[model samples]
Target: MSATAAERQFDELASLYEDVAPWPFRRDIEVPSVLHSLGDLTRSDVLDFGCGAGLSSRLLAGRGARRVVGHDASEGMLSAARQREAKEQRGIEYVSRLTPELEQRFDLVLAVCVLPYASTRSELRQMCASMARVLRPGGRLLALPLHPDHAPDPDYYAPYGLRLVSDTPHAEGGALRVELRAAGVEADVTAWYWSRNSIEEALRDAGFGPVFWADPWPPGLARVEDAPPALHAYLRRPHAAMLDCRRARVSG
Candidate 1:
């Protein structure tokens, strides 16, 4: 499969992404929130868009999803994911693009950190449309995009081993340089920022029903006040936001 400029960039970071599984933010905040948002997966067919090293794909399979298909544009990332699938034999099908047979085939689509990579509003809409295209009429999509209200301070997320820097923090489609660091490992990636209105408009135009932004709260905590002091700030200003919405069901 041919790679886009963004995909090629991810190809170089494939190894670093593997190490991301152990990052405190991913382990303690992001993953937990994502899993919580995706409540039961039994007998469900899921599409892991931007599967990236198959981390979330494996998690879905392990959670009892009947079938899991991982789709990605970066061959390097897919290679790492395929290698793990070969060893684990988890029955996941990894593909670079959706085929005719796969259209409207999934019950749910999980797009982790995928939408923010869209550098343009058109690209963002196309990404959302693709997710909608693969889902059954009433199927749902769970996505994580850069939080529209993230703190402007580049070092705000340094405690979580992440740093986001942008020349125009308020620009609707500004470039964001993301740095990930942990335990002697470091990687840099580029993403774009879109406001809540822009994101929701794209979803609606893509045939999705009402969009919901879920809080990325740590699991086992009833409220943000219940979180430890160290987590209060991050919880208030997470780097990414969770979005959930369903494809508009067919009308009679």
Candidate 2:
């Protein structure tokens, strides 16, 4: 599998990613919403698709997943993941791609902050297809793709150490080039913006059932206490969208 532009970008940033990703943002803002989407995973075989630095992979393993595997296209990211695995000894497996051997293996797959790097419709569809192939019958896929509406307001992402340098419109939706400053280093990352209809269509093409979009903050869950007051409103608007999809159960 050739490295995608997005994968290469992540590989370059892998070293600095963990340092800037605050626990408060992960536990308070991201995890809570993801957990609400995933009711329980006590014994499920989970796949952390595009598991950058294996953060979510560890999260799954810690949450009692029976088997947790992380797949990424970037060796730089995988290297970080391996280091964490060695330190934590969580027994999680880390691989480079969704190989054919993994077909119909996982009960739940989380591909957060992935997919948006597709940069093209074909790539988007192909990514979704890979997710479909890895899923067991009736398995669920939790997709966190770039939201169509991103950084609507000026200085929207500054509080999070990200600056929206450009938002260029495209046929698919748009391209967002963000300058992320973290750990005393800065990098520019470009992500493809996929529209809701396009994402849903891709999921259907990948043999998934109807796609369900989740609100950024589900009802009953309060805002992250540590989140900056300036970011609260933008968080409510969603820089990324959560999609819930399920593979069809094979009939006997």
Q: Tens digits of per-residue lDDT for model 2 on 1-252?
A: 688876788886776667656734444566777877777789799999999898788878878889999999999899999998999899999999777899999999999889888878988899899999999989999978766666555366666666665545334746777677645757778877788889888888998998888656643645544466644655666566788889988888
Full-model lDDT, candidate 1: 0.89
Query: Tens digit of lDDT per residue, candidate 1, span 35-56?
Result: 9889899979999999989999
The global C-alpha lDDT for each of the candidates, from Candidate 1 onward, is 0.89, 0.79
Query: Which has the greatest lDDT?
Result: 1
lDDT of 1 at 66: 91
Which residue pairs clash in candidate 2?
none
Question: Which pairs clash (backbone N, Cα, C closer than 3 Å) in model 1?
Answer: none
* TM-score of every candidate: 0.96, 0.90
The segments of candidate 2 whose C-alpha lies over 4 angstroms from its true place after superposition are 23-25, 167-173, 182-185, 218-231
